[model samples]
Target: MFSYRHAFHAGNHADVLKHTILVHVLDYFNRKDAPYWVIDTHAGAGIYDLRSEWATKRGEFADGLDRLLAAQAMPDAIERYLQAVQHFNPDGVANFYPGSPWLALQAMRGRDRLRLFEMHPTEIEVLRDNLKREAAGTQRQVAVYQADGFNGLKSQLPPAPRRGIVLIDPSYEDKRDYRHTVQALSEGLKRFATGCFIVWYPLVQRREVADLQRALTRLATPWLHATLSVSKPAATGLGLHGSGMFVVNPPWTLHDALATTLPWLKATLAQDDRANFTLARHGD
Candidate 1:
């Protein structure tokens, strides 16, 4: 259960899709004066070194974030997302990657709070150390826990301000993660009906992948779903071909932003002619 490590795939295509929408949601939340909490259910190590042994072993970012940074005339949303990533690489070089926890810190204001949970013991320690070094002042605004995010989430719902964004992005290494994702979201809604929820799932050939998509869409909530398929599944079906993001109670402007961004992104990340994208809302 603790085998999966995000450092291996930190800035890959999935991260592109997940973090871009995350940045948009954070930006939307900031538009209002009411303070809101950002709860990351599966927070990783907070930051990753692209040159590290784990990251260099895979070099997945070469086809993901590196492509975007090398491209020109990015869509508005994608551009903003890149800018956020650039915030971590202040020397104007993309040598490091910031995970959801770090990205949330970039957008959160003084009144806003961030709650993170990670089940992996090693990752929890790294997360805390990263915060200590890079976010010294965030001690009061951020909380990190080494516990199961899926089960621990209940205690943090319906935050003191009654406004929050719950991000459920388990690694799904365990087959049960798919089921747990659906269950967590269902329970989360009951506690914070109006809170924004962002879920990220891989586009694999597994039945659970399809089942998770179906379950999320059928929920009784206004939502938006977006996917980016960079290639057709391999013959052995051993690797991720793409990924999707489902946003419940999404911002009014989110659908349009993604509609304009996905097309260009599909072309940018295409591994073959099978590369494509999807953007749909509840009524669609």
Candidate 2:
């Protein structure tokens, strides 16, 4: 839906889980120095200002990044994420936040490249400008596309370097996106079976969420699934309670690192008594 502008929800709890895990996966790829590509489907504006009118209207960051800023003794993984956030907000003020593409760039080596696809036309414009100015020029480090990521991302498979990460995070404003999400991965795996794929999903009172998870399991690839629930679902049975990341071909060290840090996140980001986390995995 065109109405789903990410500007309003920029640094919410969902972004926290998504980007934190994103850094972990990207860092693992960086270790080999082989030069891989980071593909971001549904890439939003490259950066967001938490103090903007849209962000102020939602006030989501107060319950998201703000909670973690003052945290002491965070696990190493989470600490690294905050350090990256600090890179953008150098004044010791938590006003700016990085979207996935920006986070990938931060953790990438000189040879690493990024392919970003966004369907929202306006967001695509901002995304293009951001890459041109902040992320370097086109045909250089970044490529931005104004198209449905589900369909557009396929052309980027088995990237030039033969190593890559595909990040799929649709607005889910359309339920069809759930089916398309799995379809994109299925098609992508046929071309690059070993490529890392990360799917970010919201925790809501909806059946599609579970169905999507089931479809992912049927892919039968080695994977890790982690979710953070910050509070009980609302009595009205609406809105997001948390978010999760399903990593296919995840880093071997990721599960252990999350095992150490998720509990900390659940507790630190919790909004009420029902806060918690769930972690499951197979084929390390």
Candidate 3:
């Protein structure tokens, strides 16, 4: 479990898709005057250095965010998401990438709160240091814990504000993560039925991956599901070809926002003719 590190995949196509939707959701929450809580399960290092050894080892961003930065005619939501990314690269250089934790903090107001959980030993420490350096005076509003988010999420549900956004994204290195994710979401809803839930999963050639997607869609809640395929699945089936985000209790505007953004993402991030996207929602 500790073996999975997001630095290797930060700013990749999946991150682009995941974080783009995240920015829109956070923005939607901000529209209301009531303060809300942002709960990040499986929070990785809060921020990643694109120039660091880990990020450069894969250079995943070269085809992911880098492509978007150089592209033209971005849709409204995509443009907003890039602006959030730019907040970290203040020098106008894409040297740094903020993970979900940092992005949540960046978009949150002082009245809002952030709760983060990371299971990786080293990652927890790095998350703490990054939060302290980049988000001074946020200690009172942010809480970090070195524990399994899947199990720890229940205790934080129905947060004090009674309005919250829960992000459940695990590395899925352990095959059981699929089951755990379903179980966690089911239990979480029991505690906070109206809370927004966002789940991110990789599009690999595994049966469990497909199974997980199907399971989430069958939850019988209002949801918006969007997928982006950037390349053909490798013959060896060893890497991610794309990713998807399933949002429960999604904002009414989410589907339309993604409908416009997914196609642009497909064209910008595609590595071959096989690239494509999917958008489906079950709500008014």
**Model 2 CA lDDT for position 23:** 87
Ten-residue region with minimum lDDT total, candidate 2? 130-139
Off by over 4 Å in 1: none
lDDT of 1 by residue, 1-284 (tens): 78999999999999999999999999999999999999999999999999999999999999999999999789999999999999999999999999999999999999999999998999999999999999999999999888899999999988999989999999988989999999999999999999999999999889999999999989978999999999999999779999999999999989999989999989999999999999889942
- Candidate 3 residue-wise lDDT, 57-151, digit = tens: 99999999899899867999989999999999889999999999889998889899999999899989888888888889999999998888999
lDDT of each: 0.94, 0.89, 0.92
Q: Which ten residues in a row have the lowest lDDT in candidate 3?
A: 126-135
Per-prediction TM-score, please?
0.99, 0.97, 0.98
What local lDDT does model 3 show for residue 217?
Answer: 87
lDDT of 2 by residue, 114-173 (tens): 898988878899888777777664457777788888998889988988999999999898
Clashing pairs in 3: none
* Candidate 1: RMSD to truth: 0.9
Best by lDDT: 1
List runs of model 2 lying over 4 Å from the truth. Answer: 137-139
